[model samples]
Structure formats: C-alpha cells, structure tokens
Target: MMDYQLNTPLNGNLAMTSCFHENKALQQDTTLYKFIWVRSGILTVEIDHIPMRLEQDEIACLTPLHHIEIKEVEGEYLTFLFNSNFYCIFGHDDEVSCNGFLFHGSSQVMRLKLSPEQSTNLNDIVRIFRQESTVRDNLQEEMLRIILKRFIITCTRIAREKCGVTPEQEKAFDIVRRFYILVDQNFREKKQVRDYADLLFRSPKTLSNLFFSCGVPSPLRIIHERVEAEAKRLLLYTPKSAKEISELLGFEDLSTFSRFFKKMTGESVSDFRKSNTTGSIAN
Candidate 1:
C-alpha cells in the first residue's frame, strides 16, 4: 500500500493511493471528491446506503455529499482524492467540463467502465501524477491541476460514450448537465422542473425534450430522486428527527414531507429509518 499526498496552505489537498484504507481521514472528509479506480479485482462499497460492486477497470466518481463505506476489496485499487480548494470543479467547469457529468449529476454514484486502451491511457496520466507528487516547486500545483484536468477530461469522454452521447449531441448534453448542477444546488428549495427550467432559461417542455433526447431520466424525476436521496441520508446517518429534517429540506410541514417520502420510497419515514437501523445492527 503506497500513498502520496500534496497539501497546500490554502486548504488545497490531493492524494493518490493504491489502497483505500491507507488514508482513513481523507476518506472521511466530506468536502473531498473521490475517484475510486478498481485497477484489478473487485471492490464493494456502500454508497448512500446502497451496496454496489465495482469490477476491475471500473471507476466510481463520488461527490462530497455521498456517504461511502468500503465493504470489501479483493484486489488492487487506486484512489485519487482532491478537495474543492485543490480544484473547484464548479468554478473550473469551463476548463475541465466535468463539473456535473462526473460529480453531481445524479443521486446515484457515477461509475464508468474502461476499455483496455482507456485503462492504459488513464494509467499513463496517473503515472505522471505519481511523478509530480514527489516534486516540490512553485508550479507544482498548476502542473498537477493540469494533469488532473486531463484525467477528468478522459473520464468525461468515457462517460459521454457510456451514455450514448455523440459529438453532435454535446450541446444538448451540456444542457442536461447544467440542469443536474442546478438541481444539486437548489433541490432543497426548488423542487419543480419549471423552477430549474426558469433558471436555465428554457421552457419545461424544452428541458424534458432535451432529457429525453439524451436518454436520461426526466427532469422532474431527477429532482425528486435527489430530494429522496438526501432525505434518506439524513435519516440514516444523523440523529435529526424527521420534523427537523423536513424543515431542513424545505418541506412545508412534517405531513407534507411524510407524504413525499412515502410516494418516493414506498415507506414511511420512521419505517425507513427503523428498518435501516435494524439492518445495520443485523449486519
């Protein structure tokens, strides 16, 4: 297990490791975005209470809002972690163009499976990352950011392909990605497709058409799912009562929240929490 880290005075931090357990503190940092690449073997993890398995040559892109628990690893893996201070995806979206597609696009974790050729290319970028990690210079941060951008660009390319997005559809895909970002930022306050459509300066019908053309989930469904995911995370991980969570999530009242939860998840809030707690204890 080898680890290399670069830390800056301005709260910028980046780390690369072959073993997931090498840096427990960084993994627990909610402000960090993580790219977990299963170089070889299988890696099982629970993300936002849902268990998922990643096979060799697969990568999972995780945002700070995700709750992840590494369950098992049967072989070698690589992880690259960076905080927003290191490189703000949102701020630098124009440069890397991975702000929403790779990080905050969906309620579920974004997993990309790599071809052998793609795997080799990513390995080359990672090798450069390793070499740069040992060098300290005035331009070190900039150099690393450049390499990181390349890595993200590569993944975003693969993601576009995986989603069946063609070069011609890039503009439409950008709209969908922007919608996801807006939902991530405002789902707590704005829960309707029309709300985001207004922000994006598109009609609700246009947004739906764009999403349908991209073969992605509907805008309204995305908004609802994002809200449900956050509610589940709060219920399972925090001691906040349902009422408090309802208010925190901008629900008009507890009953409204309860009804929303039931419609989204097919269970009452208390039932969901109680069952999850019991399942944890049983495990």
Candidate 2:
C-alpha cells in the first residue's frame, strides 16, 4: 500500500490528495463519497467488486455504499473526498441535483469520461479548490462550498447524459425524484411499490413506468436496496444484533430480515457482516 494521505482542510468535510502511481497499491473500503480525477496515466479501482480503469481526463464518483479497493494507479491523480452530508445540503434544491443523478445514482453508472473542453473546465474548478485551501479568511468555507457545488453540477450534467436521463420531462422526472426521496425517507416503513404508489397518488404500474422511463431501477429494488444499505451500515458500524437490526429496519422478525437480505445480496446477514469485517481487518 502507498503511504500517502491527504491533508484535511480546515473544513474537515473536504480533503485533497495528489499522487503518482508507480507500482503501488492503496486498498481500503470507504464510507465517504469520493471523486477521483485522473490527471494523467491509468488508475485502476475495484468498486463494489467491479474493476474499472480510468485514463487521463476521466473521473469516478463513488458513493458511500461502495466498497472500493485501489488496485493500481499509474501516473498522476487527484482525489477529493467528502461526506454525503456536505453534498446533500440545500435539500431538494435544483442547484445541486446530486441526490439521484450523482452520489445516490446507480453505482454501475458513476464514472464520467470527460471531453477535452469539459476536462479543462473542471480542472480550472479544481484549481479554485486548491487556491481556497491556502486562505484562512472568514469566507473560506463559503468559497469552498460554492466551488464544490460547481464541481457537483458539472459532474451531474455529465452523469445525467451518460445515464440517458431526460430531466426536461418534468412530470415524469418529478415523480421519480419524489419516489427516490420517499424511499430514502420511508424505506423502513414502506417496502412495497404499492405503498409508495399510494403516497405518490399514482398506481403501482404508473409509478414503476415513470421510474423505468427515467432510467431508474425497479421500485422494489430501490426500496430493498435502501433498506439493505442501512442494514449493512448498522451491521458494520453498530454493535447491534441481527434481531435488533431487523427491528430497526421495521422488519417483522429476524428470520424475515435474514431471508430478505440473503435474497437481495446473495449472502446471509452474518456472512455479510463477517465478510466486511474481515476485509476491514485485512486492510
């Protein structure tokens, strides 16, 4: 593993690292949202067990749910790591449409291969992050937030395009957007598509159609994934037992939760927890 770590800025929400890969391995699981910009060379990463090679001018946005191992990095690369709290501020604001299109979007479509002009634009924004870090002014955090918003907006645009998202279809987009928010907020209490459909004043079929049209996954998958994400987080970060976790996620019983988890992730709850903990130990 490479012995490199980024210095945390005064606003600890953000950190920057610059390094060149040469026969080095940096492997770990991360809970923060990570943006890695490949300035030059090839950077290889395994996110959620899928290996990706990002070349020059390409960037990867990894959500907190991913387990990433930096398999190999050759050449220069820059990384910006921040928590979802920072990214999700200004709730439901159009300025930072990051909740679905960027951070919380599908892990399969997270990377953005930048064009030359887009690369220059984003690189310039990155320079601003570097510049703002050197100052201790009262407005430093404010400046960093503005820069971060721009970075997110730029990435969101490219990500939407990559995912074939048509945000201009306001009615369909809003339905799906609301569905995402409702699932995030109520996945524990509402697991079925019919439940969400009732809340959205649309039939289950209509709701599912909207999600499919917007390139969103199936409603049941989204709801189950959200619940499973919380289950994994609690299992990894909390000292809660299976029964306790099941209760916290509003499951009727531990048996049902275990079966659901196994069905969704192809692993038993105890096995999944052990796997994650074992990886943490290995790291």
Candidate 3:
C-alpha cells in the first residue's frame, strides 16, 4: 500500500495534501472541486469512466459530481480540494469566469499540459498555499482566496489558449453561455427552448441562430442533454428511486422518465443504475 499524508483542513473550505505511491483508489466528493498537480509522476486516472494519463508538470481540474479513480501512480503528486463556496466568493461575476468553462463543464475533467514557465508559476503559487496553510492568522483565508483566484485565472488562460478562443469569438459565445446558464439553473422544471429564450429575452429563432453560429448543437438539444446529464448523475450517485428521480427532474410520472432515459441513453434507468453503481466509488 502507498503512504499518504492527510493535511489538516483549512477553515473547512480547503484541504491540501500530497501522495507518493500507488495507493488505493480514491473518489472525489460531490460537494467540492479538486485540482490534481503531478509534480513528477506518470499517473493514470479514470474520471467518470474515461481514462487519462498525466505526466510531470501536468494539471487536471475536476468539478463536483465527477467520479475519479487514481488507477496508478509513479512518483509524487499534490492535490487541492475546495468547495464552490470558496471558489465563487465574488458571486456570479463574469470577471472571474471559471464556473462553467472549467468546473461543471461538459467535459468531466480538464487537463492542461503546463509549459516550463507555466509549471514554475503554478509551483510558486502552490508553495505559497502550503506556507500559508501552516499558519492560521486572520489574513490566511483572504490570502488563500487570492492565491486560488490567481491559479484559476492562470488555468483559464491555458484553457483558452488550448481551445483557441479569441476575444471576438468569446463575444459571440455569450449567447450560448447565457443559454447554458439558464439551462443549468432551470433544467429541472424547464426543458423547452422557448422557455430559455424567454428567460434570455430572445426569440426561439434568435437562440437557435446563435447556437448554430457558435458551432454547437441547437438550443433544444442542449436542454435535453442537460436534463439527461442531471438525470444520470442522480441515478448513478443517489439512492433515489426511479419514480423519485423522475419527479425530482420535473417529470410527471415514472413512465415518462423511463421513456426519456431510454431515448437519451439507450437504456432503462434501472439498468443504468445497476451498471454504474458498483464501480462508481471505493470506500
């Protein structure tokens, strides 16, 4: 078995730790976000059934609700765990726009291969975090938040570069983003493109046009996907019954949810749960 260091939790909002072995499998908490930085290792990780390989100086961002397994590790790694409350201290401001693009994104994990300079920069930030974590002064929380903001912003820059996102393109993507925000906030009870359009003060046609221009699926498709995603999360992660999950997702009855799940995932809710439950986590 691999040895592990359980660092003390900082203010109940953040936990920092390091591991240096091929330890037992670990799963992430659904209520917190995680950043895994491989200082010097070749690690194979599985996130939500997708296998990923990380090397030295690489970083991976995982959001709440992702099922992660550290399949194998060779060398050392550092990880930071924090809740969304700590991340969104400025509320829903667009200035620090990482909530959607990094965490809670369609992709379960975002991996960034750090350049040498980038690696050095991130390492310095992590050093500060480690140094501050040892001291519990009044300014510790504020300083941690500031450092975290800097790290997230840096990661966002890398993500933007990897995706080739330009300012003009970002401007054009505003409509698509707003549509997703509305869907995320209201998909439980509202599943129609027209409803989202109304919320965004845009016509259905306009929304459809923007989605098309942005090279994404149509508004209605995105809404259905969001609903399906949440339904799957509930089915796999929670003990709620099919009927309860259906009602929680705003479906009128079990049959309706059954049909919807079958249509979207090509399987019944029961079968999906049975297949996903056992391998989801390790205690």
Candidate 4:
C-alpha cells in the first residue's frame, strides 16, 4: 500500500532529511529538484511517473517536477533537494537532473549496489546529510556535488555491466540518453521520431538502433511512450474532460484519441483516470 506524509519545507527552497521508518511517502509539489539515497532496506522509486526498485546505496534523482513517489520505503533513506539555483553552486549551469527522482542521464544514473568500500565512502556524505544543522560553506557544496556525481558514476558502471554493453555501446547509450531528453522536452510540440532524429542529426534507423542497443524499445515506440505519458498526466491532473484533452493533444477526433489512448495505455482515458483514483495497479 502507498501512503503519503508531506514534509515541511526549509528556507524558501528545498529540504533534505534522513528517513527512519516511513509508512507513507511524501507528496511534494515543488518545482525545485528533489533527490533520495537509499541508506538501508528497499525503496520502490517513481520519478516523472517512471518506477524502479532501489535497494541500499542506490540513489534517485528527479526533475521536471512531475509526480515522484516512493513505495515500500522501509528502514533508512536520505532525501536531498536541489534546483537550478542550488545546483549552480556545483557550477552546473545547464545540468539537468532527471525529473528530480530518476537517474536516466546514462552515466549519471548507474544502478549501484554498494560494495563495502563504496559504502564507506558514501557514508561520509550521508552523515553530513543526516545532520539537521550543519555549516554551509564552500566545502559543503563541493562535498555534495562530489558525493552525488560519484554515486551516479558508480551506478552507471554497474548498469553497464548488468546490461552487458561494452565501452562502444556505452557511448551510443549516452547519445540515446540525449535523444530521450530532447524527446521528453519536445513530445508535446514535436510528435514524430524524425523530428527528433533530424534535430539529433541522425537517421531514424540509427536512433532506433541506439535505443535497441540500450535495451529499450525502438525510437518510435519511445516517442509514443512520451505521448502516452502526456495523455495520462492530462487525465490525472486536469479536471478538463477527456474530449477536450483529446483535442488539445492534437488528435483529429475524440474517437481517434480515445482509440489511441486505449491502444497505448491499455485503457480509455476516462477509465485510466478512474482506475488510478481507485488503486495502485489495475487491469
């Protein structure tokens, strides 16, 4: 079961905390970026609506300020919050953290199961994060950036090993990651895969191969997934009726949009919204 306990914000910005035992996740509606590191036990992580199961030493990042919720959060977890202004301290002027809850910038979000050595190193950062009050200095920013970057590097290496991709394949995967970022950003504006491939200066076939190599679906499939995500968001967040949303999403007719939504998400837009209001996962 999923439950939520909202946390009070610190400053005019975000807040970081240490989790004890959580019965419910927190519902944060902030545009500022948020992060979490699993200190112990397991966490079911969802960022911008994408879900993953993360164990100890695994970290999650979120941006785009979409719905990021954690389920099955037992034992210890450390939460961190950041945004453009905050991350600028790290000298990352345009660095994007994946929707603030996901680690999908290829190397940035490698799944790391902390070995003993790595765990010891990460503890230093966790220790700092857990302290409710600390000295905020130049060193503090450097420490957080180093800790966060190293964590992602480690996780990406682990993810590569698990996926059986070599160094060359890994490079391709980075390009694929960039494609996704672009597609995600422009999904509502640019619907077709070619539009993305053209912008990326690659053929659709090359884009398809890149995704296929990364263990995801084809480029077109990813585009559809992007479109479908917007449809679901419209369904859940807006009080606007389905027909209006369908038209707004660029569908010619209500029937066409309804059919497309059903084909992609396996339910009518109205029913999808209805069912999600009822339960976690439904048929």
Superposition error at 145 for model 3 (Å): 1.0
lDDT of 2 by residue, 1-283 (tens): 1122332354245556674233132223244667888888988886655568989988887676666667887887887666544445336367766675455533453678888888988889887887787788778766776887888888878776776766476568767766776787788898899999999899999887778777778888888877877787677766788999999999999999999999988999998888766534322
Stretches > 4 Å off in candidate 4: 1-14, 20-26, 44-54, 70-72, 88-118, 128-133, 136-165, 278-283
lDDT of 3: 0.72
Candidates' RMSD to native: 2.2, 4.7, 4.1, 6.0
Candidate order by decreasing lDDT: 1, 3, 2, 4
Model 2, CA-based lDDT = 0.72
Stretches of model 2 off by over 4 angstroms after superposition: 1-12, 19-32, 46-55, 63-69, 83-92, 105-109, 235-239, 274-276, 279-283
Q: Quick one: best TM-score, which candidate? A: 1
Q: Which of the numbered candidates is closest to the native, going by highest lDDT? A: 1
Q: Give the per-residue Cα lDDT of candidate 2 at 109.
A: 35
User: For candidate 4, lDDT tens digit of each residue in 128-227?
Assistant: 5444235455565545555555544444454556566676775686667667777766766777889988998999888887787678768777777767
Task: Give the clash total for candidate 4.
Answer: 11
| Candidate 3 backbone overlaps, count | 0
After TM-score superposition, what is the CA distance of residue 240 in candidate 3 from its true location, in Å? 2.0
Off by over 4 Å in 1: 278-283
Give the Cα lDDT of each candidate: 0.88, 0.72, 0.72, 0.59
Candidate 1 positional error at 110, Å: 1.1
lDDT of model 3 at position 135: 71
The ten-residue window of minimal lDDT in model 2 covers: 20-29
TM-score of 4: 0.72
Please report the TM-score between candidate 1 and the true structure: 0.95
Pick the winner on lDDT between candidates 2 and 4: 2
* Residue clash pairs of candidate 2: none
